[model samples]
Target: MLRGLATINFYADDVEAAKDWYAELLGVEPYFEGPGEGGTTAYYEFRIGDHQTELGLIDRRYAPPGLPAAPGGAIGHWHVDDVRGTLDRLLAMGAAPYTPLTEYGSGFVTASVTDPFGNVLGIMYNEHYLEMLGLR
Candidate 1:
């Protein structure tokens, strides 16, 4: 049984870079880092968005074998006010374009990017999402 999305973990060969990149994108630094004592930062977490969703970066060194080298499969698209602007900003931040912004009809616009670390980050401007959040 799933309650809700508590966290989304992405693997990166360089956790620090991942942290910095995400910080720049989210406009906030990581709220948590471990395991302390001058330990190499193997993990970093940032609380972001209206819901304060957790976005985590884990060192790929600890990644279990068989994980894909590049991020793929199911994508979780975060709601945004400007899909085109966000995608452009991500690209300017060095994220390669994953999916060009496209309309899914009925006012649903979606796009995605492959972070330097190979994680796919998606953004969407959804009419239904705004209605559900009572924001529209």
Candidate 2:
């Protein structure tokens, strides 16, 4: 019943920093920046990867009430051409490695890193995803 991963949202205490950081990593500026209180940027959105998926960055002040400061909960892995390369780039960009590259066998490999904003960003190389893309 699920269509698939669409817009993935991350919250940052400093949206501007997050915007710039993500822009650099994605190799493109955000297609949209939402205005916030005090004329600050509250949100940034970038369409990235082969699918042009929407990756959103919102000011942490807008996060749901009672959300814990610690990074936990769900980690959604975005498909990438090279998990190891992507992980290396993320680490070089100051992102701490949350999980090292792991071969899951059967053409599945995955890894994750914690972004500067304290969000768990996962990357994966999935054969099924590539097959679907080829079908399209």
Candidate 3:
């Protein structure tokens, strides 16, 4: 049975840059750095959001074969207060827009972007999510 999200792992060819970029975006440095080949950092993990969800960046060198060279996969959208502003910020940060802001009505809006590291990052304004957390 599926529980809640434990971690979201993104593969990047430059894990160090990924680490720095994510830290800049999330406003917190990774709490864990895993050493990889040649004594370089192969992994970085950050705890974020109200739930302190785990977000991980792994070196692409360790990625299994058959991985897509482009961003195309299931997206997990993180809840945000301002979808439009976040999308704008992500675009300003050099992330290419993958999905334009869309309104699904009833207080549901979504957007997504492909990070410079070729990973899709989604953001959403979900009414249900906020209501469940007593934030609506």
Candidate 4:
């Protein structure tokens, strides 16, 4: 099950600049900076309410195979009350299902979707995840 949005991860070309931009946009400072090997390449996290979203900056060569090559808009992430139920609701709402809900671990389930606007959104749920948001 889900309670509220936990986080929205963003892939960025420049982590520092992106952090600054998001800090201004979200009106919050970075609460956690991930470990880096003394270089520009590293992961950064910013908190919005109880959610801690991450921004990963890595070399293009190491980027995932299917992830978007560029950034600028939301790479969707949604929290759900029930992963299966929410997926069905989204389908009824005109969202075409792209992936079926699959359990990962600890009561977590994840699935993907293509919004009407053609943006990819990931939906997820877990009791522990909800607890992390203080929603349990």
Question: Which scores higher on TM-score, 2 or 4?
Answer: 2
Best by lDDT: 3
Quick one: ranking by lDDT, best first? Answer: 3, 2, 1, 4
For every model shown, the clashing-pair count is 0, 0, 0, 0
Candidate 1 whole-model C-alpha lDDT, 0 to 1? 0.89
Using TM-score as the measure, the top candidate is 3
- Tens digit per residue, CA lDDT, model 4, 16-130: 6656655653477777776556555466566543444443333333446887653324435456777887777667765577777888878778887664434455778767768
List, residue by residue over 1-136, the lDDT tens digit for candidate 2: 9987789999999888999999999899999989889988899999987788899999999999997887878989998888888999999999998888999999899999999999999999899988988942
State the displacement of the C-alpha of residue 24, model 3, in Å, after optimal TM-score superposition: 0.6
Which parts of model 3 are misplaced by more than 4 Å?
none
Q: What digit string (tens of lDDT, one per residue) describes model 1 on residues 3-102? A: 7689999999888889998988898999999663356888899999877889989998878889999678888899999999999899999999888899
Query: Estimated TM-score per prediction?
Result: 0.92, 0.95, 0.97, 0.44
Off by over 4 Å in 1: 36-38
What pairs collide in candidate 3? Answer: none
| Residue pairs in clash, model 1 | none
Q: By descending TM-score, how would the candidates be arranged?
A: 3, 2, 1, 4
lDDT of 2 at 124: 94
Candidate 3's residue-wise lDDT over 5-27, tens digit each?
99999999999999989999999
User: Predicted candidate 2: what Cα RMSD to the true structure?
Assistant: 1.5
Which wins on lDDT, candidate 2 or candidate 4?
2
